[model samples]
Target: MTVALTTPMLLAAGPAHALLPNRSCGTVTSADSTAAANLNKVLTGKLRGSMTAYRLSCARAIADATRARGLPNQAAVIAITTAIVESVLENNPNKIDQTSVGLFQQLDHWGSYEQRLDPAWSTNAFLNEMVTLYPNNSWQNQQIGVVCQRVQRSAYPSRYQPEVADAQRIFNALTAPAPASKVHLEIVGADGGMWNTDGDYAAGEWSGSWASLGGTGLKALASAVTGNTMHVYAVGSTGRVFTKDANYSTGQWSTDWAEVPGNIQGATALTASVTGNKVHLEVIGADGAMWNTDGDYAAGEWSGSWASLGGTGLKALASAVTGNTMHVYAVGSTGRVFTKDANYSTGQWSTDWAEVPGNIQGATALTASVTGNKVHLEVIGADGAMWNTDGDYAAGEWTGSWASLGGTGLKALASAVTGNTMHVYAVGSTGRVYTKDANYSTGQWSTDWAEIPGNGAGATALTASTTP
Candidate 1:
């Protein structure tokens, strides 16, 4: 699945509104024993005072509130610290003083009893006032405790100081790298069945079983992830383009395939890229030329007829969209890689394809991804070893010599980029899946390949994309 920019995908739990066990004298305890016990029970371990269970929920509430209000992480930290100092990260519905309640311990002046109990609503209320008090991210440079005191104006202003360390701990844990929710794999079976994993590869199981879409003429398949929907394109045996959409949000797929108006020929290759709401589909046409069409899924309509990209001898196709530029790559009949540059902003494509500087003429399959201005290409060499090349899109040139990502019996390839990390997936001739991870920030790929447990024998095509 090729990733398109959209909303953040993460599992969210609803707020727990029960009150924390009350403390005497209105002095907030270092840790709520009952809350800690409940958290440990949920986590199956004793991580005292960390508020492990509530951390993610409360953090998400703070994040959503700040984003909606255009506030910064600094403001989020201030709110978190205030909540930690007041209720130890517990949603205390009972008033500690005169009608104070919820995570931030806001009084009746903040809102109604029910409003104060709603974690998300209370978070928004707190951030709204905090931003009003310290506009333009001015609170970022101040001490966190001081910022919290300024926002809360608590009777004991110094009380928030001791909770700073715990607040920072919770914040860091919440902001740490989340597990990928949208690691998707689409494969064309030898029987022409379209098989797909339900974007749950991170859980070590590709959905208990692969879903068979029951298509008989699919030659090559490609998919793109935009928001909560996965758009799939496959080449029919008769050289026609067919598309189907799967809504991850609803766990449903279009009941039937929709024919895309395109005249493709022979054994076709399919690849897609997304620019904003527009999805561009590229295919190796029957006439050996490249054909392209686009649609705005948001508007629920296709744009125009398929336009010939005017290229020949293209065998395998792959594409990536970086900002306003779309990079389409293909393996020529002679085995060398050729690329066409399309500028969406200018509504123009390069008149001719440029040869990438590498000896990849005999490659059987290839995949590509874009990170920032750099495009990374990996190909299964004629010798069955994986070879890679990096292109500088801004500089309009290939940057380095072809490097070997050593492997043998490789039969298929797919790749996805997350942040500065690129994950490459491949299937070996023995029907085993393997992965090679590279960090673009550190300029290195894993020296060895890790094999996936399950066998993937007889897969004709493999494609991958990450969810937003």
Candidate 2:
């Protein structure tokens, strides 16, 4: 049978004021010795010292999580009680175990070890299990012993009451919540459009009727951080640079693509690091030189007019924003990456070009961030090999010489880096999308190629979704 925890399980034991006083658990009022002993057995060495801190942290976390689910304060109590009775605030150590690992003492055999050890993961698993066992949630009253007897069917079912009281106290004392990490992710879908979400794999499909656009409709997907929305400016098929937005919120798409001042072609979209709501759009001008327009906006309207960024060439890739400045690198026919940018306030373009060491141009996928102000660029070399360079863009120095990550199959490459984790995805000639993800925690990229879901061969495009 699928066991679960339900709403009723969260009901306060006794009077709310009498049972738990103030914001603190009052006077160590445990239920009974029997319940206490069972709790002691499970809790063991775990719940010593900092009782106040422990109780506050756990209680707050439980409350925060339940609040999102529209649950009341009592459910938090239930989660706390269960956690206290199980691992006593100490998570299970990392090691192969016959039983599931974690604060819930889960056995590794149940699932992957990596997931089992994650605190949030363990909490989620326990909550799911609770949902399964106590579908009606009337289980809490059996006292800890009777309730545990119904679910765990422990060898010693009689020892539930004592443990329950301790669990309750721990549940009450530790009630502070964990802090949330704020981020902004801008997702560009296949249709020359952009949206925002904090999830991975943003979803949208080509809704076009034209057969020539082929089943080959665009999916210009991209993701950045979380929270902030994307600024998009593109040259439409009509020979006009049409702009729109799908950043945060819902219901309707932005209407009317605005026309830019100059006669342009091959326009690419990018955001500025130092300026808020500023988009730097680069395109090949009528003279075949690279020209750009910089405009700032908020709430989906342009506040600044399109301005000129003097340069030349078809080789331009937007640098990830850093502080108040953003770098745009370009390559001419010789196949080398070049750089230029303006500070946050003036929004002026640099006068001269600086070449990156080694012949590095033509169809490149790049990613960057503020941490150390670093940049990573990959390109399909003349020999059809994949070469990468990593270094500080502002300093114009390569940290290390160019390294060949792999060969041949690097077409349509897209890269994203968050914290220390770097992920690169590309379509292989063999008709499969290949992936390389670096785990920041371990400081290493995974050695195998992970295939994306629902995509195989046949001209696939790779974009990372950093929302959910």
Candidate 3:
């Protein structure tokens, strides 16, 4: 299974957003560094309170993340202003009140402690909710402080206004553009041990060699990233689910497995996404119904018990998110593909599942990636070959036929996108993993599938997630 929740892809059909001219992330400019260095001297007097170089950099991160989502300048102002009011523009990890933390003083309800403390992840989470609350561009007519208050539900709601001007200048200075980064990968290898490596998009190569995170009996897996913090979930042969945490920022991985709460046994296929306040999960439960659950995984808890999504005899789950709406796909018992939508902004789901019209049937694995407004769906067909199609949520349609991505004896599969190219990996009948790439710019795929080197043979299932 594959899920996409980052900013829209860098597409071949058009240019990047004007304010965020670069597709890269996590870069701060030399000029911005100088400005940050001078902040203590220049901001001795307060707009509401004084800001240090660190605080200014936090403001810049907030600004960059907001603009990357193609949101307006005012959205950045509102987010920065809210952070200033809540934490004096700091990414505070200490719980201040009622489990509250982060620059926005968000409680664990917003996410795990690590998520709130990650400036990039926290910024995206704030924007996710703001867009949801202000659906249909409603925030444009409201005051910036009012928008902040509505999203925050703060006890002291009036403080945000006094800091808006300061936030606006900070947002402007940091919105110039930044460098690029790709979502790094961790795979469950042939040995049932976890293996991870970093990728360099600029060099088109793995930045590091595959290294092992020792484990055994892991059959299937899914993962989600909140900045560099990764929460990995795996299903054992007996259907018991286990989770582990990896903080790439600090180069550490937890040595023990933690059982996720909520009696999530007998789950077969799984998918997860990083949303506004939590890591949302979709599992094909023991009863063959799609079940949903989410939580602050860093703290080892689910938001609640798993609730059924009510699909009959479903398998092979893959989901994608576009503009606050999530499109979930499943392969029904009869081998037909079905889909439903959840509008996060409105807190509603499509009334029922709709059959996707195509030659796609008897799918054992499904994975998808979003390029611009369209989702490119790939499936391993009943005939043991790969097929591709597109679902355009903006237009509310799916392709009537499937094109051949061209692989043979393929088993389980997963995909991820970086820039204009989509990378796909699949488990072959021999249990070895092979990959191929599709270039959106040239509408071409590698003529022959290339096997990924190293000890990844004998893999059973694969999952991939994208992070901004």
User: Cα lDDT of all candidates, in order?
Assistant: 0.76, 0.49, 0.76
Give the CA lDDT, 0 to 100, for residue 58 in model 2.
41
Residue 202's lDDT within candidate 1 is 44
Candidate 1 lands at a TM-score of 0.63
Model 3 TM-score relative to the real fold: 0.64
Residue 367's lDDT within candidate 1 is 92
Ranking by TM-score: 3, 1, 2
Error of 1 at 273 (Å): 0.7
Candidate 1 wrongly placed segments (more than 4 Å):
1-181, 198-208, 263-267, 394-397, 430-432
lDDT tens per residue, model 1, 1-468: 998969988889999887555322122332333343444444321124355434446555665566677766666777777887787666776876888888788998989988887777888888777667778767677888887888788989987767666555555555554434456777777678787764454454455456677677688888887777888888888878888888877879898988876444563887899888889888888788888899888898886588889777778888988779899988888888888979999989999998888666688788999888889999888888899999887787786578888999898788987667888888777755678989999999999998644444567777887774
lDDT of 2: 0.49
Overall local distance difference test of candidate 1: 0.76
Best by TM-score: 3
Instruction: Tell me the lDDT of model 3 at 337.
Output: 84
The residue-by-residue lDDT of candidate 3 on 407-466, one tens digit each, is 889988888787678888888888777788898888788878987656456677766654
Residue-level lDDT for 121 in candidate 3: 88
**Which residue runs of candidate 2 sit more than 4 Å off their true CA positions?**
1-228, 231-234, 247-274, 303-305, 358-372, 393-396, 430-432, 440-442, 456-468
Clashes of each: 4, 57, 2
Summarize candidate 2's per-residue lDDT along 1-468 as a digit string, tens digits. 998867575656684342212222222333223334433454533353334343444444544555566654455555555555555544545443355455455675546866665555555665566556777665444354554445444565555445555555544434422122222332233443433323233232222111111111233333232234433344455435554444543523356545555545544433233245555555544444555555545454343344555555444344556667667666554666667776666656677766767655454444333334666666655555556676675685775556666647555565655446666666666645555666555746576776554433453334342322
